[model samples]
Target: MSTPFDLAATDELLSTTRAVRKRLDLERPVDVEVLLECIDLAQQAPTGGNRQGWRFVVVTDAEQRQLIADTYRRVSQSYFASRAATPTDDQTGRVRSSSDYLRDNLERVPAMVIPCQQGRPESLPLAAMASYFGSIIPATWSMMLALRARGLGSVYTTLHLVDDGEQVVAEALGIPDGWTQTALIPVAYTIGTDFKPAKRPPVTQIVGVDGW
Candidate 1:
């Protein structure tokens, strides 16, 4: 169902749910209903064969989050070291700033949401791959969209993949063995909402004719 909100506000929210890091208020707590409401919205996204192969693993305990946070930091340091090596031009500079913000504050964010797919096939036909990803990616985006609406912010990050510690983290959180952790999202309230749209090239520049 559509929100009972003005078009302009809807458009603004659609355009501006940025991957907030430094601006995420680590000290503030996000309520349970807000998270559940977002997940409910996420359930509406299209899934292949209506199989709906996605699962979300949310982490809230301090000890578990601490372990996950340490793993995140270990990988984040590598990411930022390379980030630091990049040329400090306008675009890279912005990247560097965001990287710094995330590196410094990833641990403190109030919640961690890990969106996973139901299965991990060793190999698949190209068409199968398309269908498989089609199932979960939309739900993930819907989750992000939901987050934007409820005065919360998040970033799609996968640095934890470097550790392959999902089983350990899963054990810590009591998540069953079959589910794989695809991406880790740190959810929290933003300090403010005055975000600007990211700069990108015009779509026409990348669009192709029938013949490439």
Candidate 2:
């Protein structure tokens, strides 16, 4: 155990956990135990009613990955097709183009992780939506952080839910009926660990005082 300093490393990890895409090393195989460890940590995240109803579906089979990627592409293409581009800013233009590339090549990724929440019988009150999603997103971030520390990279994408047919894809993957598909994460060992934080607006700009 090389324990000279720990919290510093953790603070660094949280700050540097990047949403890696092209850097994901598709050729290397990821160990199951590593992913499980991350999942275990994810479970500790809060859930609605402390119900802990989230389910994770992992797809590693070659054929299954193909189907999933194909579905994602179909839906993503349709979604992208509908959007109009305004070259108003460099970042916006770059993001739109990058998304197109990711959608077109998603099939090449090695693994897919789908995070689902247990379906509630009735629509939740609008006021509770924040807390409801809050429970699952933290755990998801935890998983990504764990993966980054272990030399892996993943991107959270939901466009895969479009014409790609999430329901059919779910059935093909044997995901039980009620596990709602909240998001998908493609996993792979990253080629490099030298990721930097993304460019973004200052936190103060978005954060509001107690009352808006």
The regions of model 1 sitting more than 4 angstroms off are 1-6, 209-211
lDDT of 2 by residue, 105-166 (tens): 67677777888877642377875766667777888888888888888888888876765377
TM-score of 1: 0.88
RMSD of 2: 3.2
Tens-place lDDT per residue, model 1, 87-117, is 7778668766886777666667888888888
Error of 1 at 46 (Å): 0.9
Tell me the TM-score of model 2: 0.88
TM-score for each prediction? 0.88, 0.88
How large is the C-alpha RMSD of every model relative to the true structure?
2.9, 3.2
